[model samples]
Target: MKQFVFLIDTGNETSEHKIHATGMTDALKRVQDLKNHLNDNSNSDLKIKFKGIIYENAF
Candidate 1:
């Protein structure tokens, strides 16, 4: 299985501008796409999953 992890920082001074522009929903969608991309080529025959989301000090 492919595990996707997204660490979002609302106030990450050094964060990329795209993060703020795309927001979480769109980002997670990209993650789903990534999982699908990996699943298509992997030989493990496992399911794709999103672990836990840890949020702190969300702006």
Candidate 2:
């Protein structure tokens, strides 16, 4: 398995989330699900931005 890191930026603060998957395709699906989940549960005044995904060991 591989590790995928996602940066969530909400103007004032930034947060990191890690997802473990078999490949990029699976990782991306999980990321999208995360975005949808956040959007669904967040307040109308709050905005969520996804900076990008970092692949572990890609460097």
Candidate 3:
């Protein structure tokens, strides 16, 4: 798995997420999942500013 730093900017607020995924595809899936969760619970419209893998295990 890899570690990712995701920056979500909602017009009014900004948040960061540390995610673990195997690859880019999975990382995107995780972001979508997070978007869905936020949409379901929050009222603001959030947008992703930066999404990239920060670190990977040396295994």
Q: Comparing candidate 1 with candidate 3, which one achieves the higher lDDT? A: 3
Residues 1-59, candidate 2: write the lDDT tens digits. Answer: 57777777655667788888887799779978887887687753334444455556776
lDDT of 3 by residue, 1-59 (tens): 68877899878888899888888788889889989998998788888855667666565
For each candidate in the order shown, give its overall lDDT on alpha carbons.
Answer: 0.43, 0.70, 0.82
Total clashing pairs for each candidate: 0, 0, 0
For candidate 2, what is the lDDT? Answer: 0.70
- Candidates arranged by lDDT, highest first: 3, 2, 1
List runs of model 2 lying over 4 Å from the truth: 43-59
| Candidate 2 residue-pair clash tally | 0
Instruction: Decide which is better by lDDT, 1 or 2.
Output: 2
Runs of candidate 3 with Cα error greater than 4 angstroms are: 57-59
TM-score of 3: 0.79
**Per-residue lDDT tens digits of candidate 1, residues 1-59?**
22224432223221222222134576567755655675576544434333344344455
TM-score of each: 0.40, 0.67, 0.79
